[model samples]
Target: MEGRIAAKAEQDGAVAAPRRAPSQQRSRERVERMLAAASALIAEQGSDAMRMGEVAERAGVSIGSLYQFFPDKRAIVWALAERRTAEGQACIAAALKDVGDAEGLRQAFSGLVDIYYGLFLAEPVMRDIWSGTQADKALRELELADSRANAEFLVAALKRLRPKADPAELEATALLVWQMGEAAMRLAISVDREEGDRLVAAYKRMALRELGDG
Candidate 1:
């Protein structure tokens, strides 16, 4: 079974998708409960140590019911990861929606970094879910696509602020900066709080400086 799972992971890039998506409202709510339970357990124990049986127990669903929705632990993890990614993308969209001037853009850009970082910092499960994606090709592809999607918001803001800016340049710049910001944010959270603070502050300064100069 382990060998088969490894083979599937290599072949599909993602672990496994949900065995079945919920079709009814009741089924949806039950699935949500299962995912919520899984998230909490992941937060407490890390995804690697979390068990499917524990998730079923915590969600107050039978093992059979859980398996009906998710074929394995990886499916649950992927579901949670997808939810987090969507939330992150929505957060970015909202953060960059309003920009009146260069100063406003700069503040919004720096503020966005803080806001997104705060989400990951507050949710330990976000960190664990993120690490869970590292070994999968599909999730890695998803991450890159997500970066581009998120960068569109930033680029839109830039186009509004600098009406004369080249569209291609703005796009490439936004994509690079957003990707770097994500990497830096991950780094910022991986260390001691004091040092993390320093790193975040430095990243904000550098990013904001670039925004100002552009």
Candidate 2:
């Protein structure tokens, strides 16, 4: 009887294990659908127009399923913001790779700014989310952390550029650079493409000069 019971338990475990894969896959697919729907809705009507029902309908899922994946619209927006932030961080990392010393730092800084500017320009929704009502306190905190990470990246590049600079001064300079770049990108979005390009170029030059590289 003990052996039979053990055999039955093993059989139940095997049955449960097979079910787990499809269950997890279904969950992931549902979440992906929700995210895709949210992105489309936000792009078409802005965040204000995004309703959970609309997301569910667009994703071809029921409202209950939508809630299962995301608690509310804010949760959806937060997930989107996190995705965009990760993409930006990856781009910055790629741009800085193989970069050496201060002069390399200057080039890396300019490249990083250009990549980020292009990213935001390509995805205006991201800018709208950042500057619009979609931004809540939680999202704002996330943005602050993201900004700090970018600043730290700049600091690392700067240290390579100016190995002799004081640590505190290097950190301060990195923070300034990060802020300046962010402001430049925000301003660029309002102007004509040519003007925006010029603005970014000017900002890059100013940043380089500030770092004493120009």
Candidate 3:
């Protein structure tokens, strides 16, 4: 559950950062190719079985070049996961903004659930990457940081909805909602599609009702 949004301290050795940051356009393009290759391999098989050399070969880059940007397979997975998280953050911002009433808030909550669930269903690689986070403490920490970031977006919206509510209380509520929502999504993906949709719908209804009460 915690690994869905997983930890954020990138400096930890467990996940392994890129050997060097790509600054130039050519370097960035190469990094993107490496990521795309790794993502495809992870989707085709699993991160546990994806080999660095294969990724490099698929990307049409040398193995040395792959290692230059990603020290190991975990780093590649982390990059892909982090990129997806960024996309989620943007979606969260868009879905939760401009809400000033109960109806609007409910719609926003629904949007959040639908958008995230859609992503999980559409992108199989995310499931594998998130699962890996549970075993890697560094990746888990990365998720925690990401969870907090997502929670902050929720808090911002909550602050608007509950002007008189204590800030600390709202922050706590935001984190709780986010983590549980992530857990729900994780669980939803683990089951059949029909059951998964039902689970997502149930969570959305429960969340909307609870937040509506606030």
Runs in model 1 lying further than 4 Å from the true structure? 1-13
In angstroms, the error of model 2 at 143 is 1.8
* Local distance difference test scores for all models: 0.79, 0.71, 0.81
Query: Highest lDDT among the candidates is held by which one?
Result: 3
Tens digit of lDDT per residue, candidate 2, span 76-128?
77667767777777777677766676668777777788878887788757876
Model 3: residues with Cα > 4 Å off, grouped in runs: 1-10
Candidates ranked by lDDT: 3, 1, 2
lDDT (10s digit) by residue, model 3, range 1-214: 2233332344344666666779999999998899988889988999889999999999999999898888889778877877888888888877777877778878888987898899889887988877666788876776777778888887888888889988998888778778788789889999999999999999988877767666
Q: How close is each model in CA RMSD to the real structure?
A: 4.8, 11.5, 3.2
Q: What TM-score would every model get versus the actual structure?
A: 0.89, 0.81, 0.92
Q: Candidate 1 residues 82-123, lDDT tens each? A: 677778878778877988788888777777788877877899
Model 2 TM-score? 0.81
Worst 10 residues of 3 by lDDT: 1-10
Candidate 2 stretches greater than 4 Å from native: 1-23, 133-135
